[model samples]
Target: MSDDTDDAQPPRRLNSLEDRNAVVESALDRAIKRGDFDDLPGRGKPLTGLHGSSDPDWWIKQKLDSEGINGVAPAAFQLRKENAVLEDTVDAFTEESDVRDYLAGFNARVREAVMDLREGPPVFTPPRDVEKEVAAWRRRRNAMKNDSVTEAEPGDPEAEPGYQPVDPESVGSPRRWWHRFRR
Candidate 1:
């Protein structure tokens, strides 16, 4: 009876490519049914940098950007960003001495970074001419002052009597809650 039962069973064939695919698909379906992937981060977000480059490091770069990491940026890139905001930084200071000192420090750092031998994209920023920048800053400040004066003059048809332009710089810096607590 045992020999008859053994002979009655058919031989099992090795799984083919299609059979393996079906097995994987079934396993994925089971996982989905169990809500295994419901809470994953970036679930509906479109993939980034997919078409930007074929570089093998694309995934790593994407991960860094997604995490708001700035330490990974190239030195040249960081310098370029700083250069772009340099004018705003200079304009934020109301004193000529402060502006000159800031520009001098910035130029020195740029020169030092340019002299470094580490391989990266070339720094394209030229050192700022302090005198020329100071002149330009003066011109801008004078123009703003002239505009405010002209707007307030009584001779102008649209002038509001007793209207005075507020100097934004005179406002003291805002204090944070932590500062108040410390005091």
Candidate 2:
């Protein structure tokens, strides 16, 4: 009979931690030789999260930032952002009554949110004064109007007042096919 022992492979025994480590290292080396780790995404880049915060929400924040997601900010943060743009929102209205109504609605919402016992960052935005906001809006609107008027004046010596010169070369002539079709 042929010897079965001669063809049989020996079983590996990890008797200690060092032997286990050596086996793992050998496997890793083989994988490296085979280029198993080459061409990986973010390869050679400094590993992220080393300098980042230890907060558990760090991954969520990073994902949201990388994906350009919005509306994920905390209620307090959202409220602060809304307050920052409140002036612009008020200025959008041309009528005093509309501005008053918008300010009242905004203040009411802020009050409601503040009164709620929900836990979040504290809302720091106080209620806005309608008269003061309206006055500021008027000043802002007048300044914009003045700036536009100044900009529209005939600044170029070659151009007439309120007339902007167009370059004929820049505006190419219609295609011959278009003219033929139109005719």
Candidate 3:
């Protein structure tokens, strides 16, 4: 046991930048040999966000976008963002119960954010009126249903102009040059 302990090499000291670089290079080389990075996503694609543009916070923005991170902003900003898309989000839900629940949660968050005393932007996002929103959602849903039902199928007599169905029986017959103008 004493001989085995003595034979084991001590950890290498990385005192200089060059020494650190060499250590990292050797570890990366070993990883390459082990194929640790062989199946990474976007391995062959060109790197994005490298073009010239004047954006001071580009790096953080890129990181946030790449990581699919959301709801990490200040409460005021988050509530505002949610408010902007509230209508569309409400429309996406098929159930009235779900819409009510979503609206309740959103309203609670807005109220809480308004009450928060920590120094930040003011929360101007008002709590959504659940009943009104639900009513609007119902109206939109009904309108969409009506529109779909009203749409005429292709080859329908009620279909819009410029839509003519071709005759299968005449498809195999060769017509004269004047046939094209006869229509």
Highest-lDDT candidate: 3
Q: Please give the lDDT score for candidate 3.
A: 0.91
TM-score of each: 0.44, 0.44, 0.53
Q: What is candidate 2's local distance difference test score?
A: 0.81
lDDT of 2 by residue, 1-183 (tens): 579988986979999999999999999999999999999999999998889568988888889999999877555677778889987887788888898898888788678768865857777778788789888888998997887677433566544546567778768865676677784
**Runs in model 2 with CA error above 4 Å?**
1-11, 49-64, 67-85, 88-112, 120-135, 144-183
> Measured by TM-score, how close is model 1 to the native structure?
0.44
Per-residue lDDT of model 1, residues 1-183, tens digit only: 667887785754537988778778988999999999998999999976667677987778778888988756677777788889887888888999998999998889788879985958888888899999999888888887898776545576458657577779867987677897784
Clashing pairs in 2: none
Q: Which stretch of 10 consecutive residues in model 1 shows the poorest summed lDDT? A: 149-158
Query: Each candidate: what lDDT?
Result: 0.82, 0.81, 0.91
Worst 10 residues of 2 by lDDT: 151-160
